[model samples]
Target: MAKTACDHDVLIVGAGISGIGMAAHLEMMCPGRDYAILEARENLGGTWDLFRYPGIRSDSDMHTLGFVFEPWRHEKSIADGPSILEYLNRIVDERGIRQKISLGTKVVSANWHSDRACWELVVDKGGSRQTITANWLYLGTGYYDYDDPYDAGFDFSAFQGQVVHPQFWPDDLDYTGKNVVVVGSGATAVTLVPSMADKAASVTMLQRTPTWMFSRPAKDALANFLRRILPEETAYKITRWKNVFMQDKSFKTARNKPEKVKQFLHKKIQKALGDHYDPASFTPPYDPWDQRLCLVPDNDLFEAMKRGKAQVVTAHIDSFDATGVKLKDGRHLPADIIVTATGLRLAVAGKITVSQDGTPVDFAQRFYYKGCMFSNLPNLAVVFGYLNASWTLRADINSEYVCKVLNHMDAVGANVAMPYLADDHGLEEEDLFDFSSGYIQRGKHLMPKSATTLPWRLNQDYRVDKKALAEAPIDDGIMRFDHVDQRTQQQLEAAE
Candidate 1:
């Protein structure tokens, strides 16, 4: 049986970056209104808390990832997981948000109560159930959960060596003097394999396909130094804007022209590893960011390989035995530790079981309003970041807009709002993303569409978000709200 324990003004579903940002904004904007964040995990920092693999760091710089209110004091733009987690914890503590956080409470479902115009949420924790009735619900559950990595038909238990999935890396597992095979070619694999190779006798990154490796400065020293002399805000704005532009331009080049991307990526790879690294394995067949692009930490992964600490083997793995992995190409790499850095299942709403009054909407059936909100759901705002920059950059804008929405709703005495799309084109689930990953390709029919490039296509341009959220009128015609007429109000008051 469902249990009713508490009620609040707003019930936030995740305690991650977006969830924290929402709590901070709500408390800052509406001072005393009751609100609470329900976290499924026992800790905070959703993605950072989950992935413990070495070289696990932010792909985007800190300047953009950081909240506008809090200036990241560190000189390093690309921060490690621990540092990022510390910053988030500090934000929560400084804001006195710990009380607002409800740990070990997992929200199973949020059912809308039309009569009360609020949500009756069922939460499970410590083998008991509690129901929270909230006027508003904010979702911060990330796109992926490392705790339960969905099986892609690859049997992992049969592997003989110490199997360490990045989702849950055991600290006690010793890889020293052991042959380790790291599966997958994404950033996690790139980051962990090189670092693991330092201790492991030999490291191999197994891949079913090719990947694009782009060189990046180890740390932006100049960007750091500028923060000291220049105003903190100025330095942040400069670095943030500059990085966004550079990243966009680089991505655009790959999309608009294949030849240029090929030449530049190949040239850099060749220069970094000299003649030892094979160009074939390094060369990506698809365009950059087609699947997820690999970011190199000052070309360290290749350097480790050239130095004979690591190697990249491109092949499909058939199965795993107690001793090692058997490749489809009739090769066996005996390993003591196997790290499956395989990709994750792409989910938009963090598996919260989204529905409306016991009527569940098929994810494939609904059309996207803004990459940020689902059409036809009033007062329900979704958080989805740009595919280009860090997830937080776009999320920051989304949080700000949500605040605007909240304030507007209070002023108008309207508790419901949903951003509706004018033209669905009958195809939101078309093959929008050109990636070939199992998650992307399989879920394409269910994901949002992007027919035109920027602005309308769920693009990740930060400037575009600034214009849309900050500059545009909050009560734009795209979203509708209901207000009682003065005659109806007077009649109700007289009757009362």
Candidate 2:
């Protein structure tokens, strides 16, 4: 026997940045459409609250990362974790979004009933289980797994003073005056190295290969200037466009002129580190933006390296020793603590098992529709941000697009909207995410494929997606709309 909870027009999974933004959009646009947010954690703030590692901050500027409706009034564009969390919480409280949130409720699976034109979700709250139904399901659960970090299968029991992954940093463990060897050269390691440097006796970033890193000011001068002269919303819009255009241009330049971009990056790094910079230690084998660029605000990492508090070592780890990690080159780096900032273990749709009409829905076999929803998946939208730009930029567009979709369905007296790839659509399957990052590569098989053309491909460009998803025709022939009769709804429930 199962208990039934009240149904909602929309059910948002995850109360992170994306979920919060989605709720606000629904409240303002969808008026009477009732919705609820289900967060697995006890509290909200999602990633910002979950990641409590030292020196955690946004890689992108807050101008573009902040919600379009809410301007980030902070001095620092690349904000720290606590400030970001505060911003998220403030939005929830000010908008009364907490009333719609069901905390500590983990949705296990979502099964769609075609006849009923609704979804049946099995959720676990505390020790009891209940069934929740919704007309639309929005997934804001981020791509990575919160519990597990990709450790590269290293055995740490032999010689570990304290092994930690930034994803699951111990609350009480202290690294003061400790000799720490931070593994990997990604954003996390770079952030951890500089942050731990002030306290640690020495911090060494050990990487199999070097990554491209460049510096910018911790504060946004243009955003500040605009705020002082213009109205709050006006300044925010201007700053947001300024950053978005710059980021898109930079990414295009890197893609088109890889050699020039590489040289420019190398020169920038050389200037930052002065004569002490080693080409081999700081230079990446791939071109700029081959993987997402690591951000070093105010040249903090370079300054730390120049100050002799931290260093970068490019070497492959052979194995773990009783005292430290042994390099394949026969060099040993001694450490009192090891932080594996290797990568993340990716999970799709929060690892939920999806079944359509009693058959399992393999996301790998499906194509992404507008990078938000999947083909054949009705009334479902998964929020995945842009790879080349700020995450929220794309998320903002997605929320608005979903609102348009919901409104269109309601206006037509349609109960559901299903996307399908037609045989004549003329689309070649490509990986949804084009990034060469380790986490993406590891989880590529689990993700949905995309077409080569519009409406089917995941347009990572915010401008393109905004026009296609938000402004394009809602009845684009790809999404089929239909109404379910009372008898059909009854039969669908009986089949369950």
Which of the numbered candidates is closest to the native, going by highest TM-score? 2
Residue-wise lDDT of candidate 2 within 413-444, one digit each (tens)? 78778887765666787667878899998999
Question: Which stretches of candidate 2 lie above 4 Å from their native place?
Answer: 1-6, 423-426, 491-496
Query: What's the residue-level lDDT of 395 in candidate 2?
Result: 81
lDDT for residue 448 in candidate 1, whole number 0-100: 53
**Which lDDT values do the candidates have, in the order given?**
0.75, 0.88
What residue runs in model 1 are displaced by over 4 Å at the alpha carbon?
1-6, 156-158, 420-434, 445-457, 483-496
- lDDT per residue as tens, model 1, 194-237: 88888889999998877888878767876788887999888877
